[model samples]
Target: MHNPRSDKPVLVGVESLDNVQQLVRTAGDLADLGAGTVRVVTVAVKRSDSPFRVFSDETIVREFADSSHELLDRATTPEGVTIERDVLVARSAARGLLAAVEETDPAALVVGWRPQEQRTDAVFGTTVDALVERAPCDLYVERVGHEANGVDSILLPVAGGPHVETAARAAIAIAARNDARVLVFSVETSGDAAALAAEGREALAGVDGPEVPVETTVRESDDVTGAIVDEAAAHDVVVMGATRKGSLRRKLVGSVPRRVVDQTDRTVILARSGDVVGGPLHELGRLLRRW
Candidate 1:
């Protein structure tokens, strides 16, 4: 079932100006869908006090806030979408972003993923890893692709999961903004392919948003990740839900989504429903694993 469109602003967390246009654009579109604003936020790490330091903490924060505003100024926000900018000071990027989520109470939190080459050890990255388990709002982790010049077409792969509805809504919101078409594709290895196809169609049908053309397709493939990766080549963007896994396993993007993000160059948006929050012990375990 589709939930009502949230009127809360969409919050986008950025580390730098690099590739932030796509993120801001996506968040702007999502905000436009709900008649809300887009708040672009960047975190400034608070450095420890040193007697020999050249600049004071206040000076450092001022410089960082200036850079943050410059970054926001560079972002090409969608027309008719209100945009706000902020620079948060915290011990780490993850802490700053989590604090922003708590203060803003946004409907969705948008973040970017570094390419595999840039990050080899963590699943997504340090900040994203922490937010994946703790963010209190829906999460959209974008892996921007060079080929995704425009949102002319969207590839949305669905399987029954808590996040399918959110993914569908996101796809539709983007499609509506770009006047693009959505292809709701599903892969089934066995047992009632037609049923799964029907469910895919229903997922799109239930989304409440601007009218956009949507098509559903089901293909039988022994390799779900390979199928998604191959089909993703035909579209400009791929929007899919996190895998259906328990909370601990959910700390990382499901294996399929992780592989798809790794394999495909198409701009991928991995959506996760925010209904589940990991407890303190689980959070501690994840931190230890990362260390």
Candidate 2:
């Protein structure tokens, strides 16, 4: 499942100072997994012409680029990994990031996320959500905090779906570089626990995390999200797949990943399988709901 030819750059979308360290760590992880260049990108709001305009747009853009470079320079780059800095100005952060993705065509887009009390504006609830829906390549959203420090132990939540297989590949790629342990966690609400556990193990057996040890467990729980949150508390990172089911409205309001980001302290990476699905109206409604 690992692409030997995927030597493309890994683009990281960094927002604030709070997430810079986390984003840097993520870019390093990706670089270890055969990705060549690590591009760190930040977006600034595009100012429109107005009577109150004080500074020229060119000056503002230069200042923003300079600030972004300064902040990214604080990050430590891994060996063999080239760090590239990008400053994008658009109507919003999400639009700016999407434009970058289009230009770069990266192997994956790494973004940082933190729980917000309220986000009343934006199309995808937040920039991360919007990028998830629109990004051309695979997406990895890292939840930033004290819990997202290291990659010693990694968790891969699987459900025996196509996305699960994709997620397993992602886990193997990431674990290979860090020598991290892979814990294949699954929840059994209706089926046999033993069967689910077996299936989880089989899904990960082909991709053995590049010599990294992998363990599988299937627990019975009515609240899947709650179970994931509890398990994540014990692990450093939880790598899961992009959600396929659920209404656009629900995805906008609150999806499994969103819930996990809000409730869990551990870092998360939502892996996509490059499959095109529909739900633009759902996204549009959610964006409109904020107004």
Specify the highest-lDDT model's number. Answer: 1
Which ten-residue region of model 1 has the weakest summed lDDT?
A: 47-56
Question: Which segments of model 1 are wrong by more than 4 Å?
Answer: 47-59, 118-121, 145-147, 246-252, 278-291
Candidate 2, residues 1-291, lDDT tens digits: the string is 333436788888887877786777676766666565888888776656642246665665688776765676677667777888887767678888988987988877887766566665442356766776666677776667644555787888765444565566667766777778889887888786567556656656665335678887788899988988899888878888756556653342236766776687667777764444236764575467457
Candidate 1 has what TM-score?
0.87
State the displacement of the C-alpha of residue 159, model 2, in Å, after optimal TM-score superposition: 1.9
Indicate the worst ten consecutive residues by lDDT in candidate 2.
Answer: 245-254
Candidate 1 per-residue C-alpha lDDT over 1-291 given as tens digits, one digit per residue, 9 for 90 to 100: 666778799999987677678898889888877766999887777646643156655776677766665676788777888888877777678988988998988989999987767645567877898888778788999986453787789998887667787788789889998999999888887776667656666777777778899887788899999999999999999999888754554443687898898888888999887875556765786587568
Residue pairs that clash (backbone atoms under 3 angstroms), model 2: none
